[model samples]
Target: MTTPTPVVFIHGLWLHATSWEPWIDLFQKEGYDASAPGWPGDPDTVEEARANPESIADHGIDAVVDHYASIIKDLPVAPILIGHSFGGMIAQKLLGQNLAAAAVAIDAAQIKGVLPLPLSALRATLPVFKNPANKHRAVSLTAEQFRYAFGNALSAEESDALYERWTIPAPGKPLFEAAAANFNPHSPAKVDTANELRGPLLLMTGGKDHTVPEAVTRATLKQYRHSEAVTDILDFPDRGHSLTIDGRWREVADTALDWLRRQEL
Candidate 1:
């Protein structure tokens, strides 16, 4: 019997591993083994995460990245790494260490080549960076906030429901780190994905996403220009940063699945 390819999913900030439940189901049906590693102390459910937001306060990029890296180390076989937003940065970091069979970064957070800081992105992150006290706290989004930053392109009911189900307080430090990434020489947000010769790397962007705009994604793609292996970019016109949870999530997952199948994993 052929061995199944392992798939590791890393969710973006304010979300836990459960955020990938639907995608995990789809991957399993396709004969793949999947695991969604939580950021340190991430609660299993949105309600629980909200109830204990303080637990996530110390989960900075380096800590979260190392936690996932440790999980990868114990895997019997190298797995395909898939991540979104901050999780994307972690995926790239893992790829840099040469740990995955392949990787897909979706609406990934600030990384090398993504230098633009659109006002909307700033506004979306303001709630976290408005005060120095937030640096060590967890910031939860209000319904209106989630609507603007995550579900802007979805229907009201769908957006509201997603907020209720997936919204949770996220560590503030990572957002601050991403905001200062370009200027900080020692930012943990930095990743040298240009060494793409390691394996197939796919960067997926949500065209209508205000948080991680298409322009930013395009800039990031340029960094991989010198990669030896396949480096590809795909944009979903109608999707927002919340593409993984909003309506039509299955469509986005299928698109990624198609790409994963082509990799011969």
Candidate 2:
């Protein structure tokens, strides 16, 4: 008997790990062992995370990468990673380190070498950057902010419902680390984009995303130009950052499943 492949779903800032529950169930039914593990310092539930924001504060990019790495080390085989936002960035770092079989980065956050920073991206993150102290804090978004950052492609009503259902306070440290990545030679946001031996990577971007715009994803793609390993990108022209969690999330998941099948992973 053969063991089923494992799939790990990593959520980005503001959304609880459970936001990936639907994806996990679907992946499981399709014959893969799937789980969505929360980031370091994350509580077991969204309510707990919200009630104790301090418990989730002050973790940086390195911490997140390490947390996921530790989990991967314990797995029987390296899992295929599907990450959104900062989680996407974490997936890339892990895949580059040869820790995962393959990775699908959806609306991933900017890494060290990505240079294009759109105004909307700035605006989307302003809530965390406005106060320097936020770097050591956990920040929550208002419904309006959530709408702009993750749900621009959805109606306001749908956006607000998503917010209520899955949103949680997110640590601000990763944002500060990514924002200063280029300036820091030892930035934690660095990814081994040049690893010719790394596993396949698929970068998925939302054309209407405000948090991580299309230009950023395009530039991220260019960063992998020197690698011989498979590094592909897919664009959802009408989608926003919420493409992975919104009502139409099935489309994105199916796209990823199709890509993985093509990769034979």
- Model 2's TM-score against the true structure: 0.99
| Per-residue lDDT of model 1, residues 130-224, tens digit only | 89789899988888888888888888788889988887898998887777787888888888666745778888999888788888888888777
- Give candidate 1's whole-model lDDT: 0.85
Model 2, which residues run further than 4 Å from truth? none
Regions of model 1 farther than 4 Å from truth: none
Query: Candidate 1: minimum summed lDDT over ten consecutive residues — where?
Result: 190-199
lDDT tens readout by residue for model 2, 1-265: 8788989999999999999999999999889999999999999998999999999999999999999999999899989999999999999999999999999999999999999999999999999999999999999999999999999999999999999999999999999999999999999999999999998999999999999999999999999999999999999999999999899999999999999999997
In model 2, how many backbone clashes occur?
A: 0
Return the TM-score for each candidate structure. Answer: 0.96, 0.99
Give each model's whole-structure lDDT: 0.85, 0.96
| All models, RMSD in angstroms | 1.3, 0.5
